[model samples]
Target chain A: MSRTAIWYWAARAAFGWLILLAAQVIWLVADTAGVPLSVHVTGLVATAVVAAAHVTVMPQWRYRVHRWEATPAAVFTQSGWFRQEWRIAPVSRIQTVDSERGPLEQLFRLANVTVTTASAAGPIKVGGLDRDTAQRLVAELTANAQATAGDAT
Target chain B: MSGPGGGPLSGPAETGWRRLSPRMLLVHPVQEVVRAAPALLGLLVAGTSSGGKGHLWSAAGVGLTVLFGMLRWFTTTYRISPEQVQVRRGLLNRKVLTVPRDRVRTVDVTSHVLHRVLGLARVEVGTGTSDRRHDSRLKLDALSADEAARLRVELLHRSPAGQFPGTQAPAGQSPTAQSPTAQSPATSPVSPAAETELARMRPGWVRFGPFTMSGLVTVGVIGGFVSRLVSEGNIDLDRVGPVRETWRWFSAMSLALEIATVLLALMVFVGVASTLGYVLAYGNFRLTRHAEGTLHVTRGLLTRRATTIEERRLRGVEIDEPLLLRAVRGARLSAVTTGLRSKEGGQRGGSTLLPPAPRTEAVAVAGLVLSHTPGATGGPSPVTGPDTGPLTSPLTSPLTVPLIPHGPAALRRRFTRAFGVHAPILLALLLLWVLGEPPLWPWLTAAALLPVTALLAADRYRSLGHALTSGYLVTRWGSLVRRRVVLRCDGVIGWTVERSFFQRRAGLATLTATTAAGAQSYQVRDVDLAEALRLAAAGTPGLLDPFLEPAGSASQ
Candidate 1:
């Protein structure tokens, strides 16, 4: 995990909150809907307060919680702040390795690596890694996966 | 009967692409007609309103349907090659689906009333993928009953020479144990190999029907229809003669009597409906071991279903005891195999090894299935010598072995969660009453749920346990549907440990064993964090070792 992940998280949070705030603003401005002014003000206040708190606290908390490590045998990752998850996928069972970078991630030079297995329980995503690190991780995982035998199922 | 390389050898006539049973032509036209009934009716109405053109249009509609049915027969062709089973279809856009012989996991043969009447059956070849997409499976609809049966046998009997030497020895030796006279005519003439009847639906098992609650679905459908009719003002119960008289008589009774009468009627209705459903679905239920290393399940009344599961694809077995069924000591057994229909899929019941029967019987069947798993590498060796004899205690097999409880921390967590959710709701209701909603009685009534919730939480804790057998990871959980899942250790593909803030504070974690079979991921909920790590480490030996942060720091 990179230190710049904090900025990336903050940016992502801000972008999401902005969209929600915009929706709230539009709702408030729509006078034809006939919602009382007090309800609109209360909703806006609540949204702003929650958004501010989330934007400030979530990034630092997530940075502290998020962890990732890849070995020849398996890929291990710990993610999420409130509901943390530790995923371990054995190298033999890994079907595919992928690296993704969103617009915000690209700006912060951060990326996420996802390793999927035959299980529909979903892929293990190690997010908020330095771009190069994510690339290297994907390459290493792909190589190890290719070396293993069997149909992975 | 097998080819040079042990695969099903296709005859000269069978090697080339062949069309489905020509008898399908009869079925397809009728099916198409039924499918287009609504459209045909609309067309008929249009033609009638506009005067005699309706007849011509209706004729054209039926003709079009028949043509489409005929076109289907012309377009579709299948081939049974030594290496693959291929189905090439589609008119404008030709498509070919090839499934390797070795990859065939299950072969399901189904026939509805119409198909049965036509002496036809549908064969669906499952290629052992968890993917639920329709095209993922190779389905040949409306094959002659005999051809379907033979194809099913051929596809699954890849290793024809391989045999289970002592697997079902008891079952094979005991001729009196089986009542082959009861087998359906469709299955009786197919294979002459030694068949071992593992389990059969006893007549007394119908008593466990109501506990299954499948009849509730029927009741819901009826309720929905009635409600729709009432809402649409199509039928007025008060005006209807018999209904009006019944309502009058019902209303004449006292409130207590009315309630009791309604409850009694509902109970009786559910029992009768569920009993009927059970009889229809599992009337001739039989789980038998075919000599060709497959477990064949033949069941159903009106729509006879015969499912063939290659024993090698079977990963484990699940012994499900729903709350109601558990009360009556009834449990259902389902095979935890890959490539079968998912739980959400309509044909999900195809995986059932045994329907709701005695808990002891369910356990015994599970043992029989597990003990005979062919080529189970690194799995626990089968318990030799008459372990299945007179299962006085249901907990004799690894499937029913005692589990390691998640401990006091998990119990506390369960209580905390239960109280945390319920007490707040009670408080909220109190607050609502205080704020002048004027519902003191409702709040008082709801307060009664607090004790029930506490009891449920305790039971949930009691149910939360996991055990690692020599070859399986057994996990038990849930309150309403307590499932004891015994997953083969070799089937486990990955491990995931989850921790919420509350769990972190309590030093607890929920560990999930991810697999491609059954429900995909079975969790050991609210175990000690250190214990969860240890379990994960042991469950898949070298997979978690590289991730562990040294020996002493694993508790962290």
Candidate 2:
């Protein structure tokens, strides 16, 4: 297994902008509801700065830091834009393997693979993979998990 | 099937689907009413405006609750074959849930005061899903006590691995063993040595009740209730204008007296609540080891519960000593076991093997339980005084030793973390000062807390130590509730290494051994990078060898 497609960052950036648009609308409505002009203006400005940082600067940083590896024995995921997390889920512990490509991801030809285990932290999501790669990973992981299902007990 | 309630609890000779006790239809509505009783004050305020209409809605609400209860009773039916359990529920949109026999973990029998009086109990089947969202496998609202116990034992016996299939079982025992339930129809006698009583609640333990955290919890509950009342406008000062003025006038009469009177009242209330909470939860606490490699825990007064955990599901044991309890030489013993936990979403609601007892007695019981338990081998290098009990020799148990204590670096790390938290608040205070007249009280409070924070950090650093027992890895930490866990190294599934930028700068990393047991992960926090790697490698030798070696670097 290898790294996810670079287009994943663009998909995430699209979500960031959508959230900014929602914030702007909420602030505008609040302003109409007799809210102070300064408060609304400050809120809009803060949202805009965050939106800009998220779409442009943060995505590049995220792409640099994010990583994933699917070995025969385990799947390792390095995620998070700021507080990075490195998670390792042994194939023996995997309960289910699923991949999804939503409306936003279809534009970028990317999909996310979720590997769930009965562990406390729940699932490990490997996002931004090319749709075909994600589907292949899911298949490979499912087979590997099935092989080791009863080996531990 | 619509027979009298006093028939054979097998339920009127049902053919395929078995309905719950007809008495169950009343249980849900009663529970709903009790839960909704708190919200009645808000309804009262609404009643003033709506008049009889509000009462009509309340009646409708009761009617709807009863309807739902009746529908639930009518629609819900279950079939338990030897291989699996199947249940179908939902009136309009029907649904079925199938839980395989091997997947069934715990079948707990619980009966509250109401259920006890009505000769009904609740049986919940849990698949060891500690994650709260998808936790309950099946919950039968009401059943006869005898049936509940039989069902629990039978369900547990069928799933021989005990909790779940994929977890470890006892030594040399396969998942499909002799059916204990069917074999022992008469509650057959067993060898005296095979069954040992681990811990039984003494009236003496109740002396430590008022010192526990129950008082604080009760205060919080009462505070929440009062705040809810105020928020709902039911206790608005404006509505009780003269009463409010009278309270003010009374307070003005003598401020210190007023405070003293309120404090005395609160103390009495909290004291009574704490004692009552202790009695209700831990009154008849008993931990006994059964013949068939199972530990049975029976406790509670107003609500009775009997939980049986397979020795195989147990990874190890945890001994927790809260500050107040520690000061009083008391401790609580819980298990670091897999699938023994139910996601009841309570802080204090797990397999608490030993309620707050004398430290020496708790240690003796812990020694006995661990020695009998499969994973835990011998009590770790005596943390308490030797027990001179005539019944059993506690000091003779093999003690775990060579507890590795962190060096000076850990102290520095803790102090840094504590000061890092304090710096921001101080900066905010400084900014507030610059904006206007400084808040003298806030600054003074911060100044007072500074020493306390430092002391707590030092204590936490003191608590940072790790030990490798014979079969389990013993890690001790935490300040408020000092938890020393003995986890079976063999049960560890994987390792998680975490290094934040700060930790990396400090040449430290946190190594967590992920297991299915206990909290699913036991962490060695803020240890040196090399030490963390060494521990991971030592805990599971060749598993972490790739990550520790340089070739793994190339792969990453």
Q: Give the candidate number with the greatest DockQ.
A: 1
State residue A41's C-alpha deviation in candidate 1, in Å.
Answer: 11
The residue ranges of model 2 lying beyond 4 angstroms of the native Cα positions read A1-86, A98-114, A122-145, A149-153, B2-14, B23-33, B36-76, B87-97, B131-137, B159-195, B222-268, B340-348, B372-402, B551-556
Off by over 4 Å in 1: A17-57, B1-17, B29-76, B82-102, B133-137, B161-194, B224-240, B345-347, B375-397, B431-441, B550-556
Model 2 per-residue lDDT at B318: 77
Among all windows of 10 consecutive residues in model 2 chain B, the one with the lowest summed lDDT is B377-386
Compared to the true structure, candidate 1 yields what TM-score?
0.81
lDDT string, candidate 2, A15-56, tens digits:
778877787777687665687778778877777777777667
DockQ score of each predicted structure, in the order shown:
0.43, 0.20
TM-score of each: 0.81, 0.76
Clashing pairs in 1: B47-B54
Q: Global lDDT of each model? A: 0.78, 0.68
Candidate with top lDDT is 1
**Candidate 2 residue-wise lDDT, B1-556, digit = tens:** 6223333322222355677777777787788766776565467567766674667666666676667667778888776665567678888888888787666766667899889987888887766656465434577777777667656766765433343333222312223544332222112133344446778899988887876768779889888987887777356665678977878777685767888888887888877887778888898988987655677788999899877777766667777889888888888877767675422412535567788778778777777666644422111122222222311442233223445777777779999999999978877887787788876678768877999989889988887888654445677787877777766666666667777877767777777877777777888878776776676666654455444443243212
